[model samples]
Target: MIKVGDKMPAGTFTQITKDGPQKISAEDFFKGRKVVLFSVPGAFTPTCDAKHLPGFVEKAGDIKAKGVDVIACIAVNDAFVMKAWGKAQNTDGKVEMLADGNADYTKALGLDMDATGFGMGVRGQRFSLVVDNGVVKQVNVEQKGEFKVSSADHVLTQL
Candidate 1:
């Protein structure tokens, strides 16, 4: 897994907007910026929908007040699903819903979890990382089926 002081891996994530799907590169997104990047195994899952995503959405302003430039949520789903979820959760412009459809970015970060037993295939492990100008400053990764460290409140305390 990526550790503190490590640079974020180079990869592309998709975001669906009114302008349609756009490809965003991690290099472009994180360079010269302090960003909070959090990942969920899949979009609209129980814990993710009920707690993870909403916590970040609710605390986005607090996070930005600490000098965060971007607050992003990544999931192993398509851009369409991300867009819909963002709208449903009222995160339209508050959080950037990034789609790691192929799990390229997840695997590159070494945070890919084998959820085959759950019939979900390869998905990202629940994680939150603070990245400043492309380098990781802090990381919190949740254990299998757990939701302790990688949370908005926890990341806020780290900030």
Candidate 2:
């Protein structure tokens, strides 16, 4: 799994914007910036939609006030789904929703989780990272069926 001090791997995520869908590269996104990247098992899941994503949206200003350049939420759903979820969560100008549709980036970070038993296929585990200039500064990976550390409040303390 990705840990503190490890550099973010090469990867790409699909981001849907007002213009259209755009391919966002990890390099360009994290380069020379302090980013708060959070991942959810899947989009629109109970915990994710009810708490995970909403918490970040509520605390975005507080987080950015601490020098975070970007705050992003990633999931193993498609760009269209992510865009819709973002809208539903009212994440505009707060959190950037990134779609890792193929699980490529999640696997690259060693954070991919098998949810076949749950009929959700491969998904990224619930986790959060504070990455600065492409290198990880802090990491919070939640245990299965738990939402303790990888939360907006917890990350704020870390920052």
Candidate 3:
């Protein structure tokens, strides 16, 4: 898994909107900004849908109040699924949902977890990272199936 203070890996992912495709680069997302980035195993899954993501959405206002420029969520699902799931979660355009469809970004960051035993395939571990101007400042990765850390409130405390 990625650790705090490591230079964030370079990667690009697709974000689909009703209009068309939006290509997002990791550097561009974090450059000259204070970004809170969270990752889930997949979209619409139990823990992620119930706790992980909802916490971010609920505390987004507070997070932004602390000078955060962007709050982003990433998963191994494709852009289409990510977009639909974001809408279902009632994301108020406050959080950007990024699709790491082929595990490219996940693997590049060294946070990919294998769950093929349960048929989850290659997926990102549940984690949150704080990036300042494209540099990693903090990282919180939860134990498998556990949601103790890596929540918005937890990261907010760090900020």
The per-model lDDT (C-alpha) reads 0.93, 0.97, 0.89
Per-model TM-score, in order, reads 0.97, 0.98, 0.96
Best by TM-score: 2
Candidate 2: tens digits of C-alpha lDDT, residues 61-99: 999999999999999999999999999999999999999
Which scores higher on TM-score, 1 or 2?
Answer: 2
Residue by residue across 1-159, what tens digits does model 3's lDDT show? Answer: 677787788999899866787888888778899999999998999989998889999999999999898899999999999999999998856788999999999999999999899798999999999998978888899987788778988998988
> Which ten contiguous residues of candidate 1 have the minimum total lDDT?
86-95
Clashing pairs in 3: none
After the best TM-score superposition of candidate 2, give how far the Cα of residue 46 lies from its true spot, in angstroms: 0.4
Model 2: ten consecutive residues of lowest lDDT: 16-25
Name the lDDT of candidate 1: 0.93
RMSD in order of candidates: 0.8, 0.6, 1.1
